[model samples]
Target chain A: MSCDHLDLALASGLDLLGPDEAREFALHLPGCPACRAEVETSRLLLDALAFSAAAPAPRPALRRAILRRAQASRWRLPGPVAAVLLVALFCAALWLGATRFPVLPAVTRTASGYIIASLDPTARSPHAKGEVMLLPEAGHILVMADGLAPLRAGRVYEAWLLTRGGAHALGPLHLDGWGYAWLHARVPPGAFRGLLVSVEPARPGPGPSGSTVLATSGDAK
Target chain B: MQEADLPRRLARGDARALAELYDRFAPGVFSLALRRLEDAGAAEEVVQDVFFKIWHGRALFDATRGDLPAWIFAIARNTVYDQLRRRLRQSRLSEAQAAMLDLFATSGFEALEHLMAQEHIAELLAALTPEQRDLVRLVCVDGRTVAEAASLLSTPLGTAKSRLRAALARLRQTLATEVRAQ
Candidate 1:
């Protein structure tokens, strides 16, 4: 499998290969140990370049600026549409009040430490993605999501805390019509291996009774 | 979190995951920018821009495309280059001045490699003539083809290639020695 194609090897490593040459190299690479070694060396050399540089600390205020911008950009609706939506929301709140459905709590400050888990790709919605941030210090966990679809009539999206002990249901999420939700819940102190979000029938149970729609790490924490 | 899981956590929009990633790589990003732009304030701006774009586009990153570190450095390089271009446009320099400035813009790559090296490698690199150093920077660090580097240096391609190959061989020998020492 060895070849004297040093030029091709170096060019491939540097991303200087033309499309056809790149394709040809891709085919050649699988069987060529020497070329693979050249590419590896190139990578190592580039890494050494990074490692040898003098990294100065970033300005402290930059962090706040980034966070502020991110927060401002999330879930923004247009101005006039927002006003009409507000009126509609007021009417819906009154109707919900008469129906006796509980109100959802807002997300607050972050705790000192948290464990994060990414939702499983298979269980997630087509365009939806989510993460579970376990805030053990504040005794609450935050489930942040984007592109989550609304459940069918009488169906709800529920969160579950999966630990070595057992699966603890945290109740259904209250998503806005746009399919974004930031659900926060109070919990007793505990470690978790994973978190699961699922679509369940009306009046969800003490355990998951339907297919999972999103999930964190599959293994125990 | 494991290094392997950082990308997943980022894709899920976890702030803590971002904080961890920032803390680990920000220094390198900041330093690369600082070396390129030679201004702390500008470098900080590059860091912010790079990380913000990374967060917003986290899901788009394909692991198969390249490792996170390489992708990140590419961003840093491009951002700094854009900034340099902007400065050049703003200055309204003559063609000759602009070309000289461009050389300075490109020269940062080698200086960065030198700055990033440890004592032994740094010592070995220091032994190289300034032209040899620039050749290494242009070809290896900046990812330029040998022919392109020769054209930039206004040297014959054969001479540039031979010189660069020799410099790289020395660097490789030193690095191997360092590994043995470790």
Candidate 2:
């Protein structure tokens, strides 16, 4: 037996229904076994179709990077503590103004041991731009970026310190409505090659897993 | 490690389990992304995003509800859709068209117990008439709506819809027979 929702079932199985239509179909699915079977069969077909695509092996480095990130995730602080620390650091930054930490416009080394690096956009995000400021003596790194394309839900921009070993997660770069974000983090003791910002899932991973939005030349390497 | 034990190991924060999961599914995830995005770099990003979610969100996986591979592929599918949506937005497509693209967005589904191998799937696709194949490609592979596929193929909307329905039914019946034979 057929019902009025047959077309809706087909479209839903193909993932061609909008949110509203899909929801309506979903509500009707439990009561209608015919529509349910149609949806299941269509999904099965699509799943088979998905496997038809060519499967090229990913680069080995990508695998290593993911593993390293997974390992580092073990050391991450709990959410509440991290948030409190971030707030304290932001308050500290406000207290120490231009006199203590003067903003440098170009890639220059100030006598106060502040090293600045420019972050250029990658092909993935051409219009995005950023700057990195490093104060090694004080063990602080400041990242400022703008012109970023807004990410979809459950995604965010994250900063990482690139080293000879692997990437070290800085933290999430919280962006305002204008696609501007600034992150302040203590520079971990290590020989750093450069820094980069990547688009990552909302649940932060230890390494750069998403597309590189902004990066130093060295970091891109 | 047994496939059935993966979810448990991953939830216990076993790094080896994550690596094993990646080894099993990375190629399929990359292939799906590369097919949809057609850019190697972007496809790699999708691979990373998929694994990252699988690793970090392991606790959310309930083996009672679905198997691990199905859950993994669901994440892969959703991530690819996100990439597509981002591309549509960046291209400055009109709001109406963007809304239409939303129709293709999925909230994940339970995957089949076994997907046909690439060669087998290709062979099955080859069994379809050329017109039916093109219609499937336009809507399923190219992410086009039925109306859009109809317009592009110079066919009536109702005809295109019927062709798609027929194509899916044929494939499903063939696949079910193959499964039973196994």
Candidate 3:
């Protein structure tokens, strides 16, 4: 096929091509630098997306919430509705003289994927230290850290996904009562080269306006 | 744990095995849903549902046929499509909205294509003009033939073809520049 036809064919999406034509294109593709590059572009797009999809991890509470609801019953209900049901069930059990409620197991979310980078505290943010785990296939990044001080009333710690495109604020890192925080971002693996943590104003700006207190030591794997 | 062995353990009714699987796949599954749905609560719901199906419906997956990630991602795609449909049905959707619904639905390919195509490409794709984006939604996202997208958009087939080429080219250009910038 001509290059024009090949471009149209690729743009038409794979479903358009007949099996024979697709097979023929596959045979022809290896020798054609241009077509090969186009195909690679498609793959790279998917990779970038996969990274973005995994950028935000679900709230940790979601796990306990999901497991609790799943254990409570097989019925699928929204989180608030499920909470109401559980409360009602508890009240009824109390009225009926049953004293025990189901015990919730300790829930921990471990990164089942590879380590993208291990971050250390910068001189400006000497208390910060953590590692970023990448679930590439899953399209998620988990950043957990300790020794972070609670921000002032109007301040927040924002995590940035430093990519060639630019620094994207992953979201505000919410620290729990104990000064420990885990930020979940839905970023595709290797889409960004590094991670940066900055203490910003209460509201975020286009980019970091505060000091880079913590960051990845090297290129993100 | 080995990914291959996890499913086998799950099939044997190990709760720990299921947890291990969840630890491994939840973020990926959740990310896919979040990118598509753009709602954490809904995305979380999707992740919970995907894992539930995997553990309870283990028999439906035959390992001899394919590996676990492919099977899990197939379920993820179908679940995301279901969520999209539910959202679409809840509102009086516009043509653009309906086009988005059609775009994300995975009908043609088996697992791998669904997984790859379902990744969050909206950012890179945002480089295209609105017109080009619509064409791409129809052709790539919706898995429509270029001719079909052309007909749906009421544009000539050649125009649709050129628009798609331009859009893909733009995506490549942006990606290349970004990589160099990094």
Candidate 4:
């Protein structure tokens, strides 16, 4: 069924429609499949034409950075479900052990020195919540998270230690079956400002290159 | 490492498969990004994002939908749109320019048509008459409005519209056929 708005739809896809025509087409679009398909096909064709642009090789540093991150994540957790389960159990045991050993002076002294920061969800994942236990004296930062959406393929949950200097990657957070994950990383030396959990590529760039899923209000001094 | 096995190997978290994929598609990805973004650094970042997503999302690749290159370019297209959106958001543009961007903001749809079109962009352009191709280049690649393109080409507004409409219709029909054949 050819609509009178067909020309307007095609022009709209090419971004050639004037404001008045664009608004008119927008109103007509939801009701017209033929015009909608025309716009969709036009956009796809233009997207494909974009590929014909001059191809330049990426810098070597990018390749190295991506591979390095991927390799690090691969080695950090080698196996499948069994390995993840083992790591989860080990983390639980460590959390349990740390809490149970109250008499040890380092644990005791660090316990008082630790700053408990709430990892509040950002707009990206509103229902998600987490907490970060930053024990600077003990040289440890423990992250416990719940209600994280399962990551899309080619993505992972990464923790970052945000300082005035910059955001330093803590590591990838591997959640178990129940949508919960705990990450225990040695607190790197910095005047820590906050903690962030972002959905990053499995091979993320040098900084946090994804949406901030959970973060603390930058007061973790 | 056969091309056919790349998806499976990548899905299994094989770093080598990722390297291979990057080697194969990074240049095209970088080119597409650089063309859209016009900033080398941003383009490089897009390349990184594209490959990273490919590696992590390997499990999500459905061979039934299209081949690896198709999937890679689809991701690249979306990533470039993201970079463009980010740039627009960060830059202090005039209201008119911003409104113009708003018009083009709905340019994120991807399909098998793009994959088919990507492989045959030159051929597809060749299929159009010289005048139609020039009109397409002016309006599509150069990002000019149809009226502006008509003025530049010294063609009548009605003639330019008909030529462009016909040219686009041909390309769409050809690509749709290619998609169905696949």
Q: Best candidate, lDDT-wise?
A: 2
- CA lDDT, candidate 3, residue B133: 84
- Tell me the tens digit of each residue's lDDT in model 3 across B1-182: 77558877776656667777666667767766755566777888778667655644553455654456656665565566555554564564544335445433312123123233323256666778998888766654544568888998999977776777787767756655665574
Q: What share of the true interface contacts does candidate 3 keep?
A: 0.15
Kindly list the per-residue Cα lDDT of model 2 for residues B1-182, writing each as its tens digit: 69778788897778899999888778877877765576789889888767766655554455664456656655565566555555673785454334333433321123243344444667778878999998887776555678999999999988887788788767766765776686
lDDT of 1 by residue, B93-117 (tens): 4443343334333222222222232
Report the Cα RMSD per candidate.
16.4, 16.7, 21.2, 15.0
DockQ comparison, 2 vs 3, better candidate: 2
Classified by CAPRI criteria, candidate 2 counts as incorrect
* Model 1: interface root-mean-square deviation in Å: 13.8
lDDT of each: 0.56, 0.65, 0.56, 0.64
Candidate 4 wrongly placed segments (more than 4 Å): A11-37, A52-54, A80-221, B34-38, B83-117, B120-126, B129-166, B176-182
| Tens-digit per-residue lDDT, B52-157, candidate 4 | 5565445445566566776666667656654444445457444433433443343224435335435467788888999999898776665557899999999998
Q: TM-score, each model? A: 0.39, 0.43, 0.38, 0.52
Candidate 4, A1-221: lDDT as tens digits: 68787767656656556678878877887677777666766665765665554344678888888787667555444557535644554453343222222222111111124344556678898767666654454445567676799977989899886655567676788664445565656543334566789989898777898999988763211
State the lDDT at A209 in candidate 1. Answer: 80
Model 1 vs. true fold: TM: 0.39
User: What lDDT tens digits, residue by residue, belong to model 3 across residues A79-136?
Assistant: 4654564355334323333222111111111112222344557778775655554444
Fnat per model, in the order shown: 0.22, 0.30, 0.15, 0.35
